[model samples]
Target: MSNDFYRLSILPHVAIVIKICRAYTNSQEDFEDYYQEVCLQIWRSKDNFKEQCEWSTWVYKISLNVCLTLLKKKKNNYQNFASDSLPEEAIVESHAFADESLNQLFDAIRQLSEVDRGVILLYLEEKSYQEIADIIGTNANNIGVRITRIKERLKKLLDGKIN
Candidate 1:
C-alpha cells in the first residue's frame, strides 16, 4: 500500500492500538515504545494484508502481536537488569480515564494473563465472538468460553480491589 493508503487505512484504528499498548505496558516510556513499534510493524506489514479480514481486525492482530512480543522482550531484559523492581516513576498509570472504577478495572485487567488480557480487551471493545476468534486465531466457541472465564476472573479481581 502507498503511504497515503496506509495512513488512511490505519488512522481509524489508532484507538485500538493505544488501548492494547496501554494494557500491555505500565510505564509511559515502555508504552511509547510499544506504540511506535506497533505502528512501524503495521506499516512494514501493510503489504502482507491479504484482505481476508477487516482492516480493524488486521490492526487488532498486529497490535496484539506487537504488544505481546515487546512484553516478552521487556520481561527478559528486566530480569537481566540490576534492579529487582522498576522505579516508582516507571510505574505510572495511564489515568486517561479519571474514574476510579475504570482505573481499578484496568489494574485488574493488567493482572490477567497476557492472552486473557487481549481477549477481554477485545471483548470490551464490543467485537463479536467470531471477530475476536478470527483475530485471536481460535474457534468462536472457544472465545465465548474464554470470555466467560475471563470475566469471572476479572470480577473476582475487581471485587477485591474495588471494595
Candidate 2:
C-alpha cells in the first residue's frame, strides 16, 4: 500500500492496536514500541491481505500477533517483571490512562494469560465470538467458554478496585 493508503487503512484500527499493546506491555515505552511495531508489520503485511475477513478483523489478528511476538521477545531478552508484582506507583506511571478504574481493568487484564488477554480485548471490542475465534485461532464455542471464564477471573481480580 502507498503511504496515504496505509495511513487511511490503519488509522481507524489504531485503538485496537493500542488496547492489545497495552495488555501485553507493562511500561509506556514497551507499549509505544509494540504499537509502532504493529503498525509497521501491518504495512509490511498489507500485500498478504486476502479478502478472507473484514479489514478490522485482519487488523485485530495482526495486532494480537505482533503483541504476542514482541512480548515473547521481551521475555526472552530481559528479566520478566510480573504485572502483579509492580509497585503501585509504577503501574500508575506506566499506563497512559488517567482513570483509576480503567487502569485497574488493564492491570487485571495484564494478569490474565496472554491468550486470554487477547480474547477479552476482542470481546470488549464487541467482536462476535466467531470473529474472536477467527483472530485467536479457536472455535467459536471455545471462545464463548473462554470469555465466560475470563470474565469471572477478571471480576475476582478487580473485586474491589473497580465499581
Top lDDT hit: 2
Extract clashing residue pairs from model 1. Answer: none
Across residues 16-89, which tens digit of lDDT does each residue of candidate 1 receive? 99888877776667778888899889988988999998889999999998877663456533411322243434
Assess every candidate by TM-score.
0.81, 0.85
**Alpha-carbon runs more than 4 Å astray in model 1:** 1-7, 72-94, 160-163
lDDT of 2 at 26: 74
- Shift of residue 20 alpha carbon in model 2, Å: 0.8
- True-vs-predicted CA distance for residue 50, candidate 2, Å: 1.0
Cα error, candidate 1, residue 96 (Å): 3.8
Residue-level lDDT of model 2, residues 72-151, one tens digit each, is 45533231344445444444334469887888898888877778889999999999999999899889999998999999
